[model samples]
Target chain A: MEVAVSIITGLMILGALYAIHAKDLLSSVIACGIVGYSLVICFLLLKAPDLAIVQIVVDTITLIIMVAVVLDSSREELFLKPDTQGYVTTLTGVFLLAIFLYFFVISVQSLDILGKGSLRMAEQYINGAAQKTGSANLVTGVVFDFRGYDTMGEAVVLVTAVLGVLTILRIKGKK
Target chain B: MKGMTLIVKKTTQLMAGIVFMYGIYVIVHGHLTPGGGFAGGVIIAGSLILVTLAFGSDFLKLVKEEAGTTLIESFATLMFILIAVSGFFFGTRIFFNNFLPKGVVGHLISAGVLPLYNIFVGTEVAASIFIIFLSLIIFKEESAQ
Candidate 1:
């Protein structure tokens, strides 16, 4: 399991690099989709099936939207020649990467290695979800019954995003 | 967009119905399955998008005006909100209190308000995704011309 996780994580990093540096705009979008999908695999490996499902669907939709945007715009070359400020920009990026890597390694090492990190609320939800909500799917029970308000907020956010897209893309007098 | 070849169009026509039905099944049986409204709605939206890509935007006329889709999306949002508010008026004053009787577990109509919420969310998500795709397509077409 550890081997699988490491391999997938490495691939995810590679995909992120490709997405950042790919010359073709469409291929860059495809690389982004690859990164999203690899993250979905990582989620599944972590035993979070619900997150995997959501990630896969959202990833696909995002790819579609991005591809559509690319299609509408000019298919220009993604990376132009570096200017005089390139060295400074590269130095800043490497500095941020090093900082993130330092924090990431520290955080991973800080986690409980014995795997007893389950919280009290999670334990309660696991024990009482089926009985309380009468739903065989514990995830749904928690999402819809225990945390319905959060789901409502998510729905509102989706609605707002759709509204924003419509408003921004609206063509005047185009019925 | 003129769409793909004849073979792709015919194939999409054949498979779109099955894909749509599968999406509905996933949404309705969310209580017993891994997939819920959001995932199933995306699948349904994908099916619609497949048809649109195969047949082109000109075929959008058969589905009614874009305003109609937005209206359906708004109605679904209202239904979701109403369902949550109904929980307050019923058994307890708390929001989303799951007021209805919890039926037999592992059955189709088991999870009292869960199935209802799933249906509402499914509708809302499907309509919203479709609208987003439709608008993007329209924008692309206009810019392309």
Candidate 2:
């Protein structure tokens, strides 16, 4: 498990770096998709199947939207001439990266091991979910019943996004 | 965009139905399975988008009109709202309260208002995605012309 996690983490970093450095916009999009899919795998390895499924679908839709946007726009080659400003930007980025890495290592070391952390809500959900929601799938019960209002909010957000897209794409004075 | 090669068109024709049916299966069995309305709706939209890619926008004309797609989306959203509001009249007067009887656990018709919510959400999502894809494709075509 540790080996798999380490490999996935390495791949994710490689994908992000490739996405950042790729010259072609389409290739950059594909690299971003690789990073997104690898994170879905990481979610699955962490025993969160629901999250994995949502991530995969959301990733696909995002990739589609990005590709459509890229296709619709003028395909101009992005030229980045290196200068003093570029060097300073690169140095700042590296410094930030180092700081984040330090904090990340500290946070990982401070994390509680599995089965050691407080799980009050998780325990209650596990023990009472079936009887309270009367649904066989605990995840479903929790999402659609226990947290139905949250789901409603999510649905409203989706509707708003669709509406925004429609408004943006609407032809002036045309229904 | 015109239709693709014969092989691609034929393959999509064969696979689209199965993909759509699988999406419905996922939505209906959401309470018993890992997939829910959102996932299943996306899957269904994906299958339709695959057909559109293979056969082009002309194929959409045969299945559903542009205005009809928006209408369906609006109606599904309204249906979702109606279902939620019905809970107030029938049940504990709270919004989104599960009023219908929760049948036997593990059955297809169980889970009170959950399956209904899932169905409405699935419909709304599928219609919305279809509209989005169609509009994007039309925009691309117009810009190209």
Candidate 3:
């Protein structure tokens, strides 16, 4: 299962690379959606159902928004322009990719802090959560109590984005 | 061509309403099932997209300008934060620290503030998503036409 998951993830990463280089806007959008869908699958296989659910939902919304943005853009060189930015952008992209690949490989081999925390807390939460929070769902306990602040921050970030859009886009008299 | 599209539009409107109700069901029962804020939110957003497809851009304009989806979105966000902050006043050492009663495990009133937060998230997500699409459509139509 792990090997199959790895293969799928590799394919997804390659798809993302292709998305960057794809000449057509529609193809790029499709590739982006493929990447998001594959990531959800990858998250599921990693045994984080909550993460998987959140990823898939957020991803679908993001994909739709991005496609809409692309469609709305009037720029003729939407995807046809090759990178003309001297060596700066190319070098930056290569450096970032390499660093991300290295970290990704390292993360796969070891238990990161989050994984450790989840493993350590999973049993305790499962055993006592019902009595403490009166909730059957362990994921809910973790989200609403253990790391509720983080989730709240995420919601705030989302709201900020919405507010920014409204302020910039609202016509003068049209409330 | 335009006349043939009206039938398609009406059909999609009906479908959108059905889908929207399903999303509401998923959201309201989220605590007991696999669906929660994220899943239910997306489902609702999908339904809104259907409305766009069926009813034409005029419907979108009406919803955007008159429905106050943006205000709902903002209020939902504020309420979510306020609920989280409610924990701080209890001196529980951690925010959202199960300050209220959790109630019965499977009851509708269970999970302390979780369900409340979920509802807020669902509303924000649904409204934001609809607004996102509406803005894009408006931009495209204005620019292209």
Candidate 4:
């Protein structure tokens, strides 16, 4: 299991790097998609089916929208050659990546990443949740029932985001 | 845009419907299933996206009802807010209360207000995403013109 996660994480990092450096905008978007779909696999392997499902669908839609936008405007991404400053920045990025990876390795070795966390706050939800919410899916129960106000706010945020996009992009509006 | 070739078009026609059905399935069975409103709604939007991509801007023009999509989105949101607020006036008079009966867990009709929330939220999300996609197409056309 640890080996599988390490391999997937490596692939995800490679995808991110490729997305940054890809000469074609479309290929960059696809590489971004590889990162997302790989995270979905990571979620599933961690036994979070609900998160995996959400991640998969959202990733596909995002890919579609990005592809459409890229196809409409430009295909080839402009490439810029790096100078001394750019090289320094790249070196710093590599340094940060190594530190993060070291921390991640240490964290993954703990039992929490394997789904046996301390459950300080979640203890209330996991115990007698089915009876309390009367829903087979505890995540949905928490999302739409216990934390319903938060969910409603999220929905409203989505609506507002769409409204903003439409307002900016509308070809015509009311007179 | 004239869209892809006939093979792509035909394949999309056959597959889009099934994908849409699967999205609805996820939304309807939200309480009992792994996925709920937002995820399922994206799948539904994806099916429409497939159709639009396969058929091109001509198809979108044929369905010149972006206003109608906005109306549906507004109505769904209104309904969602109304449902949430209705609890304030119901049995317990508490805001966001589960005023309805919660049947056995894992049942189709269980989870008093979860399914309703899911359906309304699903509709809102699907409309919102489709509208965004539709407007992007129109924006591209307008800018080009």
For each model in turn, which proportion of the native inter-chain contacts is also found? 0.73, 0.49, 0.43, 0.73
lDDT, candidate 4, A1-175, per-residue tens: 7788889999999999999989989999999999999999899888889899889988988997898789777898777789999999999999999999999898877656555565766888888888887789999999987898898898899899998997887666545
**Chain B vs. true chain B: TM-score for each candidate?**
0.93, 0.92, 0.85, 0.94
Query: For each prediction, how big is the interface RMSD?
Result: 1.4, 1.8, 2.7, 1.3
Model 4 residue runs over 4 Å out of place are: A81-114, A171-175
Tens digit of per-residue lDDT, candidate 1, span A1-175: 7789889889988989988877788888999988899899888888877678878878887898789778767666656688869988999999999999999998998787634678788898998678799899998999999999899998999899998998898665455
Better TM-score candidate (3, 4) = 4
Judge the docking of candidate 3 as incorrect, acceptable, medium or high. acceptable
- Residues B1-145 of candidate 2 have per-residue lDDT tens digits of 6778899999998999998999899889888888888888888888878888889766557225557877877787787788877888984888777888888888888889888888888888887887787877675566566
lDDT string, candidate 3, B14-66, tens digits: 68788788788767766766667766777898887766656666544644442
Q: Record all residue pairs in model 4 with backbone atoms less than 3 Å apart, i.e. clashing.
A: none
Ranking by DockQ: 1, 4, 2, 3
lDDT of each: 0.85, 0.81, 0.73, 0.87
Q: TM-scores of all models?
A: 0.91, 0.87, 0.80, 0.88
All candidates in order of TM-score, best leading: 1, 4, 2, 3
Each prediction's number of clashing residue pairs = 0, 0, 0, 0
- What CAPRI-style quality would you assign to candidate 4? medium
Instruction: Please say which candidate is ahead in DockQ: 1 or 4.
Output: 1
Scored against the true structure, residue B138 in model 2 reaches a CA lDDT of 71
